[model samples]
Target: MTAPALPRHRSAALAESLVLVGRSVRLSRRDVETLVMAIALPLLMMALFVYVFGGAIETGGAYLTYVVPGIVLLCVGFGAAATAPAVADDMGRGMVDRLRSMPVAAAALVTGHVVASVARNALATGVVVAAAIAMGFRPDAEPLEWAAALGLLLLYVLALSALAAGLGALASSVQSASALTFFMLFLPYLSSAFVPTGTMPAVLRAVAEHQPITPVIETVRGLLTGAPIGSAGWAAVLWCVGLLVVSSGFAAWAYRRRTRR
Candidate 1:
């Protein structure tokens, strides 16, 4: 009887999560300004780097090609950060309290925000890729390479979205939740995103080289440009997997604490 009940419980949890995911996506659609900014800021940054700063930078090739991967990651970061406010709003407005009284699974709330974030990032990424191509950024990746790059990016987005949700659960207000995620938006600038790390000062270079963002950016850039990825690919996989595990656990713990009576 217990074994039979477990599967039924799991199925109910999944159905609850799917319903919450739809709710989150609808909320995102109504927030047109945030969605537009999430998609637009990356395009504006890509253009700035390619047209203005691209002429001044020496990347040993087209700056546009070297910079698109970074811009793509930046777009993902922006899209994921929006999850924090959504989660926080739910927490602050007593929605979590209302849901707690229902038969819904507690984890379903965070899962909804996470799934909605991934969908938003996917759309923003597609728009950024189209814009990059229009701005003369070309990639030499075959289909498999493209697949690998996108898969890794999806992992990174999942990790960051979970992290944002955790931060949101701990925040006292929606504004604080947004502030907590600002680091995600700024992290790529310290990586090999816009320029080579070797060009930086020695300390900054070390920080850029050792951080998780650098390896992820390097792996994507290599896969897209047909350059040697070396060990960056392996490092990227490990980093994304590690972050996902840690962030998912953190989100679960935070949500439980926040919703406890």
Candidate 2:
């Protein structure tokens, strides 16, 4: 033999993942309504928070500055949640069966959706940041801080997308997949993404502070606004890494179980 077959198969799997990622991205582009809503909903929420609710909220500074990071996470939530339906559609329509009959690797299927989710979230985030800036959401972050924030966001999106893909695999129908992924969109509301966690009641505040989203939001906020990150950055990293590992494993397992011959 020329070399180990395992390495060759690994290379083939990577190639398949890249090709499927392109397919997923193209599918997303064709679905203009979903893409538009993913961006527009976040912008509308940002505007509502900045103009409608900004006056009432007290974050010790401009509300726009305080809330933009939260909105960024919310945008991520919307973008990542879309992966569930896409994967679900593929499964329900027998696309997965067709792919499975080919040389396609099961991991590549979920990887494609997760990568596409990250790409969509990146585009939506850029739009949200631009709109927020136009609406007076100024950030004092240096380039390094901005890089850190983006890196953390990438991790969070990867984790959520993997989780969404797993949920999609486990769902019996596309409608059920949509319902399963709803928690991704609702989770930010319970985080410090909007108002300060201190404003909530004791139990709600405890939940908000302890949840995965809160530390991620806090880390992003601190990076952008020059606030002290302290331990939140580390916590965010740990949370993202943990979620990514667990969700990825779950996605792989769920895909196998759903597609077993």
Candidate 3:
């Protein structure tokens, strides 16, 4: 007898997962609101902070300009948090096991979520940028430089998404996944988000300046303002790459642990 065909390890290639994204979401009209809830809320928070505290706080420039990038990162953070819950739910519902047994690509399980999140994040970023522009936040850099900044931010988001995937894979329940994801949103505020590190306490400032977020914020601000990238610019990229590689490995391992008999 002829040998039976074996299934592919991953449900789909990374590219194919793009189409699968958002498919499981918004199957009905009411569910479409998640787009706004996930993406628009951050921009709304940006507006709230800028208008409420702009005069009181001094960022050495337009408050909106200084704060918007941080807000974008925060959005990414909150967006990633959603991943864990969704993944946990799928597994709890036995959906993940079913998919794994099928001919689907293994990577598709995570890529589908990541690609969908990118779409939501892209929309969110657009809204925030438009609001900033309307409020007189101008980009001093050339279009290409602006693109570079956005590209870096997107990569950072991708890394965070992978990290969240690992968390989801490891979590035994949905409650823990939801609870654990809060750190990403909380950390940026502790950085140079609303205020410059120079204005913070001496010890806090030291830590903030050297942290991963400071480099990212500094790089994005420099690009947007046509300022210098400095060492932080390169560091930001390196940290993102480091996080992606490490977390991706863990996520893969966690998935196998959860799936393999």
Candidate 4:
């Protein structure tokens, strides 16, 4: 008797990825802490910085205008870090092992998480922007400039999310994943997020000028304030693309390596 061949799982990878994205989104929505982190925390930080420190921090213009863009970028970075624990949780609970045993595509697992993280970050960005507008933070950007700023933010978030996923896959446990990924949370402090890097000490200024976050923040700030962006816009693009390529490659390698064990 001739046996019929089984259907290939590759044919359904996109569908499987979508299903997993929905699952991840559902899980995020159900968690109160996730909600707070994605929405409430950014809003709170925006208010605190713009209201409390806005007066003290003199940027030669409206401090609210100077800081709102940085706040948005900070929210995106936090959103990216949020994925590490989620990925680690799946690995810890052996959910990934069971998925590997199924006919699902190998890439779908990470893709689903990535897609969900993007959606989550978008919402978080909206929340932060809306709160900023309510608090009198106005950017002098044209509609086209606003769109460009958003595109830059999306690229940055995608790259950071991939990097965080790589960290998660490399970690042996959720605790380690959380700790390992803490760098992203503090990275903005070293750059131009809260203040101008020019005011930093010479050594600090050198680092802030050279690091990835500074260019990104500078690009966004320039776009919003109608300042000439110079080479920062291109630098931000290169940094985001380069980081995405490296981190995504590392994430795939780490996922395969972890699954083989």
After superposition on all CA atoms, how large is the RMSD of candidate 2?
2.3
Better of 1 and 4 by lDDT: 1
The alpha-carbon lDDT assigned to residue 185 of candidate 2 equals 92
Collision pairs in model 1: none
Of candidates 2 and 1, the better by lDDT: 1
lDDT of 2 by residue, 1-261 (tens): 577444455489899999999999999999999999999999999999988998999999889999999999999998998988888888887677788888677688889889989999999999999998998878999999999999999999999999999999889988899899998999999999999988799999999999999999999999999767789999999999999999999998888888886
Worst 10 residues of 3 by lDDT: 22-31
The C-alpha lDDT values of all candidates are: 0.93, 0.91, 0.76, 0.85
> What tens digits encode model 1's per-residue C-alpha lDDT throughout 184-232?
9999999999999878999999999988898999999999997678999
lDDT of 3 by residue, 67-183 (tens): 877877777777766777666666677778777776667777777766566666676678778877887888787889888898898888888878887788778888987777888
Clash pairs for candidate 3: 10-104, 10-105, 10-106, 11-104, 11-105, 11-106, 12-105
lDDT of 3 at 140: 85
Instruction: For candidate 1, give the lDDT.
Output: 0.93
Best by lDDT: 1
Candidate 1, which segments miss by more than 4 Å at Cα? 1-7
What's the TM for model 2?
0.96
Considering TM-score, which of the candidate structures 2 and 4 is the better prediction for this target? 2
